[model samples]
Target: MPIDIKQFKEASRPLSERVLGFLKDHPEQAYSLMELMAELEGKADAASMAWIVAIERMSGKKEGSATLNKYSKALEELLKQGKVTEAQLQGTTYYAYGGGHP
Candidate 1:
């Protein structure tokens, strides 16, 4: 049988929620890959970003990024959608939630 859209959405929900939740809780923190994974309670793999992207894809989410550039693009889209916000720090950029562009 074909997969149901609701099931797919449900599976991807946790990944998206975890990511957004992390940014929301740590608006001022500049998290590296390791730190991000730890905050998400995900495996601290060197390829944690890639792994998360893959998992998201498998769950039927259109957001998948195996590289920093792709991740940034995806996050930018999320920001535009008002699901997240961007912050500038020492010439660097960060993502946060609840429209708090700190």
Candidate 2:
């Protein structure tokens, strides 16, 4: 199932909630930030205008170095809240919902 970021945004939910819901809905799969972005935007590429807008709204960073930076912040917030956990493999981070610490 494809997700629509715009719809979530329009629903007046915070980005973190949207993200958590996505992860919760797919508890068995781990996702990278870009993969999560792609899934949220319903696109293969994470650089689309829709993605940029959605990310900006989520991060409140008007001029960030990169979307990944903001996304990382959101992911870190989730980690702190215990809504998500991450695993590092070969210097790459993968995030998943639940299962406590990764």
Candidate 3:
């Protein structure tokens, strides 16, 4: 469901702030955008980002984890930037570490 109008009233702020406001108003819920961010984001060093990617791989137990929609988001981000490189052979995605192209 979309955020209520009252929620959007407070959503004009930056994303972290908007999420904060949303959580404050509705502490019982969770949202997708919140899960989409990699831990530490830009602050993470290369090694750390790789570790996070591994963790996300191992720990994905959410409803969308098994769906193409969820993995597509991850594939998009990886295609953009990450220690993990992706390549498709036939229909399967293959991943490997290091700066080399997959």
TM-score for each model = 0.41, 0.65, 0.27
Per-model clash counts, in order, read 0, 0, 0
lDDT minimum window of 10 residues, candidate 2: 61-70
Model 1: residues with Cα > 4 Å off, grouped in runs = 1-11, 14-17, 25-38, 41-65, 99-102
Per-residue alpha-carbon lDDT of candidate 2 for residues 1-102, written as tens digits (9 for 90 to 100): 775897756447666776788888899999877788778656766457446656666786666636556567778889998989899878767888964442
Model 3 over residues 8-86: C-alpha lDDT tens digits?
Answer: 7654554333333333344343323223232213324545544655566678656433333443464455446553345
Query: Sort by TM-score, best first: what order?
Result: 2, 1, 3
lDDT of 2 at 37: 71
True-vs-predicted CA distance for residue 92, candidate 1, Å: 1.9
Q: Note the residue pairs that clash in candidate 2.
A: none
lDDT of 1 by residue, 1-102 (tens): 787896566547645565666677776655544345544544566376556656666876554444444445546566667877555668655555655443
